[model samples]
Target: MTFGWLITRYMYPCFLPMGEWYRTPMDKNGAILKIDLADFQPTQHLDIDPTHHVIVNGLYMPHTVIRHNERLAYCDSMAYRVEIEKNAPIQLQGFTRGLAMTDDTIFIGQSRMRHVLRIPHAFSNCCLDGGIHVYNSTYRISRFVSLPAQQVYQILVLDQDFSLERGGN
Candidate 1:
């Protein structure tokens, strides 16, 4: 199975002020590990492009990985990029983390990095905010809904019959 792993080549403090966090150089990247279940060993490793680390002020933290139509796809959180096995990374608008998909749509979670200093980049110029971005089958954003939260860590797609009023029974 493929697993998302944090590849931190350089060590940094667990906590730091916003300004310091941006200034500090941390070689953080993400990888997809192909694990051999029988021996619990990683048989292969696919690393995210190294250029991502140089383009962003923060780390290239990966959030989620899933199989879609027999292909692997994952999110590079702080870099705001999504990658499919054989496709180029898709640019996004925020600190992307959560990801969910239906037959014809994709949902990506955006988090507000309020305390962290962000340097503007080609992917996104607007300020990061907490929300869910909806995309169509072609991967074009359809809509965005802002939330009153600091971060959106995960997303779960529910069936048509699912209802919160029934307590998800």
Candidate 2:
């Protein structure tokens, strides 16, 4: 995870939260620093879980953050891929805006291409087609699912089916 240009921000600003962007120091222990909202200055250290290693450097601007199981998902639009930090890198493409996890898959919305996707068995640092891809722990794409293009902003996995909602629709 080389997040040299990645940063985190709050999706909703109703409360005017600050220090959303964070920086991971290149120290031995991987310390995190909260970038000042206004000046982009290093304000404080925001400790992440010690169990998972941070691989990427910077985050995408206007990124969305989602957590499933023990991993944190970063929808990096600038990078054009989704990164999961837990055990490995789950590479997604086409500028993801939002994501959701179901009982057996992880779904994401692509803003640039107007599509929604799913990874059957998600893993870290891997790529799949513009469809559903399942991976094993070894980071290999194992399964795949197909979706339609409609400028999806988010994906919701219902009890028995999946639903995609467009961003501007």
Candidate 3:
């Protein structure tokens, strides 16, 4: 769906039970996280969109996922295909294929095209690092670094995942 459709579906309300943009991520039935837009986190860093293009701002970094940037129109790369199961730990080989996959393993495809996603306001082009999101309660990811003769503490990132309510009338 186009960004316009996203606005109409999430930000706008209909006679049905659809909610506001802030209240949506929809569900497996509708658009999930992959296509769902997350508000950009205001930071002094440059962000990269899913199309491998630069989504910029004042402070910028290279190759890092922008706080609120998105990727769309993706395809599965057979060579780099990865599937991770729920409640199971991921080794972080790369970004999630698409936020849509819920059951079994989250499928992360490859971004091999442009035009699918675009940037609104850009600052500069830098691609060095990237990041991911961890949602509330039942949803999240835990990471730790190991050092010689040192104890490791797990770090947790809190995020909220929202979506339109499902109903039958």
Best by lDDT: 1
Local error of candidate 2 at 51, Å?
Answer: 25
How does candidate 1 fare on TM-score? 0.62
Between 1 and 3, whose TM-score is larger? 1
Residue 20 displacement in candidate 2 (angstroms) = 19
- What tens-digit string does per-residue lDDT give for candidate 2 at 31-139? 2222224433467655433233333334343344555675666555534556676545555544455556654555665544422232212233223234443334343
Better of 1 and 3 by lDDT: 1
> Which parts of model 1 have CA positions greater than 4 angstroms off?
1-28, 38-59, 118-126, 160-163, 167-169
Candidate 2 to truth, TM? 0.41
> What root-mean-square deviation over C-alphas does model 3 reach?
19.2
- What ordering of candidates by TM-score runs from best to worst? 1, 2, 3
Model 1 C-alpha RMSD to native:
8.5
Q: What TM-score goes with each of the models?
A: 0.62, 0.41, 0.18
Candidate 3 C-alpha lDDT tens digits along 1-169: 2121233122210111134422332211121122333553447454433333212211111111111123222211111112222223332332222322332223222232222132112213211122322222144443322224211112223235654458975
Best candidate according to TM-score: 1
Give the per-residue Cα lDDT of candidate 1 at 101: 71
The global Cα lDDT (0 to 1) of model 2 is: 0.42
